[model samples]
Target: MEIRTGELSNPHVIKLLQTHHNDMLKHSPVESVHALDVSKLTHPNITFYSLWIDNNLAGVGALKALNTTHGEIKSMRTSSNYLRQGIAAKLLTHIVEQATLRGYKKLSLETGTAEAFLPAQNLYTQFGFKECEPFGDYEPDPYSLFMSKML
Candidate 1:
């Protein structure tokens, strides 16, 4: 698979993001869905990437510079066709390596607390992320699960 920087103006990348948003809405409530939409993902602090396998979009993920020494994982989604193929794992590994290279001392993320998100939670756990209290603009919410890993 080829992972490359993505511009929000690209239609394929935009569509992948929209699909991810739709998937979140289907499996989580609006309030529990914290993923950045297309407009939000275009922010200067975020670097977006698209994973392509044989020219077909396979997945998408992003890293947001939360501060000088911290970063946040955002919008990790594997295409339905690519699910269970370790696509998410590869994307996550790429993001984490980039964060380390960028000098981030910590990497954090927020995901849904629902059972539908168990796979994601397990994936994060395998990468050494531990449950943590809310950070940044987030307040404690039962529907949200916050986690952080030291780089």
Candidate 2:
């Protein structure tokens, strides 16, 4: 698998992101769903990535620079066809390395608290992300679980 800087215009990447957003909506209320759509992922603060295996899109993820020393993980999703193949972990490791290269002192993310998100929570925990109070512009919400890792 190869992880590279992604283009939001790529149809494969767009479809995966749409699926991720739609899945999030199913698991949480609209107001509680923080997954960024295709257009939003193109923001100047965000750096997106796509993992490809044999020319097929395996997964995607992004890192958003919150400030000089902080970053946020966004749009992390493994394509259904590539689920359980360790694609998410590879993309995550790539993002974490990128954040460290950018000199970020901390990296945080917001995900759902629903059972559907348990695997994601476990992945983050394995990466040393611990539950934390809300950071960035986020507010406390029963449907949202926040986590962070210090670089």
Candidate 3:
């Protein structure tokens, strides 16, 4: 898969993001469903990426600058057809590398506490992320699982 910086104009990537938001709404509480839409992802502080395999969109991920030293993972989603094929892993590695290169000292994310999100939680765990208190504008919700990895 090829991973590259993306803009909101990518229709396929935008659709996947919308699907991710819908999926989160189905399995997570309102507060725990933090997937951003295209407009939000296009903000200056957010860096978005898209993964393509065979010229088809495979996945997408984003990193949002929370502060000079910290960043947050946002809108990470693997296409259903591309799931379990290391697409998310590669995208994650790319995001982490970008965060480190940008001088971020910590990377944090919040995913749902439901089974639907267990795989994502596992992916983060493999990268040394551990449970942490909510950060940024988030509050501690039963459906929210906060994790952070020091870079």
The estimated TM-scores of all candidates read: 0.95, 0.98, 0.97
Error (Å) of candidate 2 at residue 127 is: 0.4
lDDT of each: 0.91, 0.94, 0.92
In terms of lDDT, which candidate is stronger, 1 or 3?
3
Choose 1 or 2, whichever is better by lDDT.
2
Mark the regions of model 1 whose C-alpha exceeds 4 Å error after superposition: none
lDDT of 1 at 15: 82
Model 3 pairs in collision: none
Q: Candidate 1, residues 81-109: lDDT per residue as tens digits? A: 88999999999999999999999999999
lDDT: worst 10-residue window of model 1: 6-15
CA deviation > 4 Å runs, candidate 3: none
Instruction: State residue 118's C-alpha deviation in candidate 2, in Å.
Output: 0.4
**Candidate 2 clashes between residue pairs 3 or more apart in a chain or in different chains:** none
lDDT of 2 by residue, 1-151 (tens): 7778967898999888899989999989999999999888889999999999998999999999999999999999999999998999999999999999999999999999999999999999999999999998999999999999999
Q: In model 2, what lDDT does residue 21 have?
A: 88
